[model samples]
Target chain A: MTQTLGITVDNISVTYSNSRLALYNASCYVQPGSITALVGPNGGGKSTLFKSIMGFLEPNQGQVDISGLPIHKAQKKQLVAYVPQADEVDWNFPVSVWDVVMMGRYGYMNLFRIPSSKDRRLVKESLTRVDMMDFKDRQIGELSGGQKKRAFLARALAQEAKIMLLDEPFTGVDVKTEKAIIDLLLQLKDSGHTILISTHDLASISTFCDRVILLNQTILASGKTEAVFTEENLAMTFGGIPTIRNEERGTRNKEEKISTIGFD
Target chain B: MILDWITEPLQYGFMVKALWVSAFVGIVCAVLSCYITLKGWSLMGDAVSHAVVPGVVVAYALGIPFAVGAFLFGFGATVAIGYVKENTRLKEDAVIGVVFTGFFAFGLVLSTKIPSNIDLFHILFGNVLGISQEDIIQTLIAGFITLLVILLRRKDLLLFCFDPNHAKAIGLNTKFMYYTLLLVLALTIVTALQTAGIILVVAMLVTPGATAYLLSDRFERMLAISVGTSLLSSILGVYSSYYLDAPTGACIVVLLTLLFIAAMIFAPKYGLLRRSHSTIESN
Candidate 1:
């Protein structure tokens, strides 16, 4: 049976260390076997949301669940995988792509036991899925930016997780790499895996993702792709002219009144 | 003449002990240095090494094992640096600088004030020629434990140092991994004490792995290369010291430094002279 996990974020809020900066308050559900894009501006708390979901940061209030179990609990069962931003990785560290992909299988085996044949086969298969089998022996640093992203995706796929969280997988990657990633993601969704990607780039939302969560430090809107991805929602998420015009109106009115008075 | 040079050192029990002792320190430090270089913790290693000076003095005053004091203050300095970085706005470099300088100064003051029969220069610069049998056994045991732990957990530490977030996401105990590396570092420093001393410990901890990193892009090869450099340098340093009438510790450091310079000039793809980036940029 191909089991999939649905994600639930119930009133999650985060604050910065004994400070008044309430980074975000979010509530959304990501259905199983679908691609949900977390859309927001830079510093719009997108990465913060991803961090909280991955259990790296403790949310001030609320819970994240995958298929009715808590995030950590689901994680302990080897049901979740996360691909960090490419820039966050240490490219200079000496490791091969095969070893990097093998890292995903670490959670399945107990300490001291070598990876089994089945596990090794899965790692090979994961690389094949991402078209990186040829580069398995290559050191990760030797790969190009796009190839690096593909290898990272292979690592995540090798996890065999029901839920995958990718942060900025498309950022700085070329068009072909992005298309390859999209194709692999669609294949995953077909095989009953849930994937949530957090990115600032909105262009890929309509094409690659089936759902959208528009965010600006808080949940502005979220639903099926066609229902929630509106001009107004995007305007709000990107701080487009509508929101900027409101502040502009106040200054413009004041200037007009001063000119009408016609005095130095 | 070279045959006499090699046989003369083997004649004395102490010289034989020092050679084996230096080799043990070289192997452990070389292995641990792979992670240190990868994690960009060279300065941190230097800081922790100097920070242990007061601990050694205090342990001597209190009549406890010097390793205990070194471990306590080594971990303490790391924690203090981390605390200062988190609680205040100080960057890691600044925090490390302030805490290490303060601790090192405190150690110096304690060394001067206490009237102990221990040679302060020996404590600072090491006296490999004078290490006792018990000291050799301790270094052997410490080196064994460190090597065992690091080898058993090599994959985990590699992932943790390379990408901690990915490690944690994959259910590795990154906190445990972080502290384990620190503990290994402290233990490795303890092992290097009698041979390298506190002053030369940083060199043993950082130089070999750094040289190896420039030479290879595979961690396994890097380890082999690092251990090879460390063992070669230590043996050469100990051997040349007798004929040159120089301190064993200083001799080891000078050899390691010369090797580092050589690696920088001649390393395969990344060498200063053979780099491809410069050619590409020129085009």
Candidate 2:
């Protein structure tokens, strides 16, 4: 099989029915086997961009091409796995963790067919990878925040996709769980899967992501971590509000003074 | 005593046919109700059931089989409600409340307007005591088709109900899934109306499923348990009503309610009363 990897966004723009412009002529290419962090402030179109790329939302202009296939025309959608924000799901729904993870194979399983032994094995392996094999039979409503995130991650892993789009996978998780998840993402990246994550945490961007796309409705900056995390670019992306600047307080102060940007 | 009640009812052909029809309707509604409960569309089922009343009244006035008018008007109401929910800002419950009540009230007014000696109570609360052979055959046909559709689309339907976002991500036509489910629901409601009436159909569709939810964690098991409980309730209620000379629909609803209360108290893990008791014990 041909290796389907890499995604190219060419001048993509999106607007909602309420006449709110989300993305404006945004353009970027996600290289194969790279971990990219899409970082932005609240209401910065990060989720919108993710949704457009996933073909859930149609762009008003330009195009999104995934592995030489237009996103709209992509045949093997099973190649891309998406883990939506936990808050978007209803926890009270009567489903087990295993049941949720098994859903990842729905695309591959025949419409009328039951899960085969191979599918079961894959589900088990995915759960084991997330160290959630013990909780497979547990109800989703009874899980902690971190456990819920892990279970969702297990579902994505069961998809066996080449690209994973995770929306704030580490939000509201404990420090240990956060580190574990980040480490797992790095391992997946090393194993030749492309991972794109959206996060509000700038501190982890430099250490965890190979490239960072600073987004505030559009691509404010896209490059290596060191280049995109500049104090000036950070100030601009965050609307002149300084991010937590414990380590780079002097640098941010100097940049603010030089740039004459007012911070409320 | 049990043999006497069974033999006495068996002697009457209409009574035997009524029991058969109720059994078939009970099985079909119970199986489909699993999906309705899982999807949180119990109220939608209620709305569809009530909306079919106007159509039933119209068909009676036109000297046609009540099922024809009921199916047409029932399906029309379902489509109208679906369109309103998708196109308007009105919440689904509010839309359902308005549509079903409007149609049912219209049905009541139309029933009063007609000079025919048709007993309106028979239509509102099913006359299981007077089921004809034709009714039995019709219920059987509807039950078979509903079961076939459900069996064929079981996996897809399960995935759609549990995680629609993931279903959409996999390129499944989620809009088709939604409409297909509503279509099946309409069919089930129409078929069940012959045995349980509109008011009691909600109990048949919701109570068994809710009880099953409290008992099982797996979809297949939940569906199986719901069908089992519904069949048991239908048989017991029908027999009890035959012996005691009570309303069959009311008896069935009462039986279902008792089963639900029992499940709430005794079922493990998901049961509310059980969970509360366990919490108190642990504390």
B160-196 in candidate 1: lDDT tens per residue?
A: 8888887778777888988888888878888888888
Candidate 1 chain B minimal-lDDT segment of 10 residues: B132-141
> How close is candidate 1 at the interface, in terms of C-alpha RMSD after superposing the true interface residues?
2.1
Best by TM-score: 1
TM-score of chain B of 1: 0.95
Candidate 1 contains a number of clashing pairs equal to 0
Best by lDDT: 1
Write the residue-wise lDDT of candidate 2 on A1-264 in tens digits. 244688788899998867799999999988788899998888899999998888888899988877778664452567788899988787867679998998888778876757999899999999999999999998898899999999999999998988889999889889899999999999999999998999977778788898888899899998887887788888889876563543456656676755553552
DockQ metric, candidate 1: 0.51
How would you class the docking of model 1? medium
Tens digit of per-residue lDDT, candidate 1, span A1-113 = 23348888888899876564445558999889899999887777888888888888889898887778777777777788999888788888788999999988888877853
Locate the minimum summed-lDDT window of 10 residues in model 1 chain A: A16-25
